[model samples]
Target: MIGDIHGCAKALRSMIQELAPTKEDELIFLGDYVDRGPDSRDVVEQLIDLQSVCKVIPLRGNHEWMLQSVVSRGMDDSMWLRSGGRATVTSYGGSVRKIPEEHMAFFESLLACYQTESEIFVHAMYDPSCEVATQDDELTYWTHLPPSLPAPHHSGKRVFVGHTPQPDGEVLRQSHLVCMDTYCFGGGYLSAMDLETETVLQVDRHGHVRRVPVERFAMLLKGCVHWFRSRDS
Candidate 1:
């Protein structure tokens, strides 16, 4: 799974090279593919091209939602424009109209969330009390993870999300949830994780790749304790 890519195309390209993903690997992107950095158009173009190589599931982030509202729905553009949309516009040669039809389709087709047997992937928070299928847009694309950890979801599947930028450029991992937005557009790294191995690969705009270890045991034990206590109570 990959974190938010906020238009850092060089970092995205570097991370993709580092992963060397093939047709066998499924790449899930927690979106924010446009805005706030150089090359938003290139980022979207790269993502569109990636679909031909492997299975790519792209979830919609709040930024995408804002852009859609402005472009497709013809709502006010000022809010989005102020919040990184200007960079996206500039990326498309200083006008949203210049955004290609294919790229617009890519944005419009983004999913709210994706679920597998053991994992749930969303662009942002998932309400623990609700089924993943029924999660609202506010939670799925807008809400940031609370400062305090949320309760485990009823489904018990691990949730992977991006949106809450980790300023320190680290993946925030808990037993049930992981946040991979490493704030790449703001002098941080773009993060990607191997779900099966819990291995993280981060790439910076300068094309630097770093491997980070996930502290699995400690988080797992903590979650186990919480689960047991909750069951007992």
Candidate 2:
């Protein structure tokens, strides 16, 4: 599974080359494919191309919701543009109105959530009090799960989420819940994880690939904590 791309198309392409999954291998993108970077158009275009070769499930993120609001509800562009929407607009040749019909459809057709017996793939959060079928799109696309929510959630499925960017810039796993959004647009790496093997590969904006082991992740976390503490001191 891949984390929130946030418009780093080059990094996404480089990671895809590294993984080199065959036609039988399924790729699940956690969404937020656009915004905050320069290549939102390229990002979506590459994803569209990938669908012809492999199974790709793209879930909707809060940014996509914002885009939907602007495109469908006639919501003011300012709301979306203020939150990295401008970059998307620029990617489309400096006009949101000029965004292609196909790209708009791509955003509109994003799934709210995807589930297998072992894991639930979602862009943001899920309601622990209700079944997925009973949950609303609002919760699926917008809700950021709080720290108090138990892992495995209410469905007893390991949940993989991507809306929350980790401060340590590493994949955050708490019990069965995993968050892979590593703040790629904010001077961090774009991450991917092999769900079956628990292996993680990350590529930065500069195309530097780093394989993260459990111990490496622990050290990254410790460094982030110490950096914060030193700043506070």
Candidate 3:
């Protein structure tokens, strides 16, 4: 599971080179491939290219949902612009002259959820006990939260998630959730978790690779920085 990139295509490409997974390796993208920064469309193109070489299971992120809304309903561009969508628009060469055909399909093919042998991975929250059937509903796929606050997840059937950015990592063991949205787009590092070995390797935009030990996954999840309302705090 990688963090919420928000359209850092350069960072993503660099991380992919650093990780250097072979054709035998399977990669599960936790979604939100577009929005926030530049190169969302490029990221989609890269995702499409990667589809040919490896098993790329891309999950739908909130930003992806927003893009879908824009594509499906011709919704106002303000929602995405509020959250770095402008940068994404610029990444496709700021092309207002003519809408490209390939770009249309790139936005259209975003998936809702990805299921593994024993795990369920998505862009946002995941509840191990919720019987999350892989399907087409955006509500369930893009924004479903657990009924209760998820507990520290270390269950055998893990659920890898993004969207909720944290400085450290956030783990819900009882809920079987592991949050990887480490704010890479907000000057944090891009992250990647090895499913076979349960190891996590991360790199910043500048190309510093840091590997997380298996034991640390549970502990480092505590580094998440969740800031709420000023008055409430």
Candidate 4:
């Protein structure tokens, strides 16, 4: 499972190759596939293509909610204002007003509230008792979070989530729940989790690779854009 891709396909593609998923293995995405990164468009295209080749599971993040708001409510909602939404609009050449309503609808359809099968997964939900089970229940998924995480997560089926970016890529916060956003779109590392073993793997925009122990990623991995600038200077 992976979290909050946020359009970092360069890092994502590298991480996926390293995992070397097999036909039987699944590649589930925790959502937030767009916004705050240069490759939001590319990420959507990749997900579309992956539908044929892999078990690509997508959950809706707040970013996806923003796109929905743009479609259903006309970008008047704050979902598209905060949470790095402006950067995303600017990345699309700063004329968000001109972007077609139909295109926004396409983005909304790709997001989900939760996808579960023995393990509960979402973009940023952890309330074991949450009634937010469907796409319409999406508001709760983003607004509410449990103060305490349930233990022996297999009992809760190991809640995998993203949206909270820790200093590092993955935080083994309570053994069962893993926060894997890793802020890849912010030039942080992209993270992946091996569900069966509960182990983590990661790869950044640079040529670095790591297996779990993702605490140092934010400090160690600078933005690739920064790397490009340094080379030019």
Q: Which of the numbered candidates is closest to the native, going by highest lDDT? A: 1
Q: What shift in Å separates residue 159 of candidate 3 from its native position after superposition?
A: 1.2
Selected candidate, larger TM-score, 3 vs 4: 3
lDDT of 1 by residue, 134-202 (tens): 878788888898899788888999989999999899899999999999999999999888888887888
Question: lDDT tens digits, residues 1-233, model 3?
Answer: 56677777877888788777668778888777777765677677777887777777677677776766765668887876787767776876674223266666665776666666788776766444455554335544455454565654343666777776665533323346667776677777677877676666766554555555444655655444333344357
Instruction: For residue 112, give model 2's deviation from the true position in Å.
Output: 0.4
Off by over 4 Å in 1: 211-233
Q: Give the lDDT of residue 94 in candidate 3.
A: 73
Compared with the true structure, all predictions reach lDDT values of 0.89, 0.86, 0.66, 0.66
Q: Which ranking of candidates, highest TM-score first?
A: 1, 2, 3, 4
Q: Candidate 1 vs candidate 4: which has greater TM-score?
A: 1
Instruction: Give the candidate number with the greatest TM-score.
Output: 1
Q: Please tell me which model should have the higher TM-score, number 1 or number 2.
A: 1
| Deviation from native of the Cα of residue 152 in model 3, angstroms | 8.4
- RMSD for all candidates, in order, please: 7.4, 7.2, 9.6, 10.2
- Give the poorly placed runs of model 4, Cα more than 4 Å off: 77-79, 96-106, 114-117, 131-140, 144-155, 211-233
TM-score, candidate number 3: 0.75
- What global local distance difference test value does model 1 have? 0.89
Clashing pairs for model 4 are: 60-112
Q: Which stretches of candidate 3 lie over 4 Å from their true place?
A: 95-99, 127-129, 134-156, 169-175, 211-233
Mind sharing the TM-score for model 1?
A: 0.89
